[model samples]
Target: MSTQVFYFVATLSILFSLMVIFAKNPIHSVLYLILTFFTFTVHYVLLNAQFLAVVNFIVYMGAIMVLFLFVLMLLNLNKDTEPSKSPLIKIVGVIAGGCLIVTLIGSLKAASISSPLILKNPGLGLVENLGKELFGPFLLPFELSSLLLLAAMVGAVLLSKRDEVEA
Candidate 1:
């Protein structure tokens, strides 16, 4: 029953992810992405990672996707009105995407994984351990990531804001 549930959620997640990429309208794509995230959260729940699943649903499916939809609505980019690229450019993009997929698949296939990679039973101190590792060992990288995110948010806001002087 657990396996069946896992497979169902995983399949739905993958299908929604594909829809996110292939949807014609940006709003539909964002909605599909939220569905994908929700399905992934279900998969996480099936794996017994309840905290992670809730976090995924809240942070990604709820907050982040909502932000994306808000931006899409603000920009009114439901339809891509930009001029279409040439056939050669389209072909190049397809080739690049194919190469990226092939490379990722090949790397995953060729990677050597060790067995017994997880503890037989982890204690309920998962959050504490994660906090210790994130704040102590990975402090530098964690802080840098926050700074990067801040910079990205500032840059996006600046770029999106209309300039009255330009008008």
Candidate 2:
């Protein structure tokens, strides 16, 4: 039962991920990305990483996706503004994607799983444990990531303001 559920979620995640990339409309792509994130959350839950699932839901689906949609709406993009791809470029892209898929399949087929599908410490996914780990050895990386996000937000705001001024 668990294996079946895992495969189902994995398949859905892959499909949604592909949809995110292939969707012509930016809004539709963002929606597909959100669905992919939801599947990731489900996978986390199935792995018993409840904290990770909640974090994924809140951070990716709730916050990031809303931000993405807001930006898309603000940009007011439409089909008319979208550029058309050349037939040759499209063919090349398809060939590249097919090659990547084949490579992934080949690698997976060659790989071996040495460990059992069980966690050594189930509490590792708990908030307390994660917090301890984060604030301890991973403190610098955590702070750096927050700073990076802050920089990205500032950059977005500056770019938007510049666009407004130009208009």
Please give the clash total of every predicted structure, in order: 0, 0
lDDT of 2 by residue, 1-167 (tens): 98899999999999999999899899999999999999999999888778999999999999989999999999989999877899999999999999999999999999998787666888788889889999999999999999999999999887778555567
In model 1, the runs with Cα more than 4 Å from the true position are 78-82, 104-116, 120-125, 154-167
TM-score of each: 0.73, 0.74
State in Å the error of residue 126, model 1: 4.0
Q: Which residue pairs collide, candidate 1?
A: none
Give a tens-digit lDDT track for model 1, residues 40-78: 888877666677778888899788888999998888873
Model 2 — TM-score against the truth?
0.74
| CA RMSD of each candidate after superposition | 3.5, 3.4
The lDDT, on a scale of 0 to 1, for candidate 1 is 0.83
The list of candidate 2 runs beyond 4 A from truth reads 22-24, 91-95, 154-167
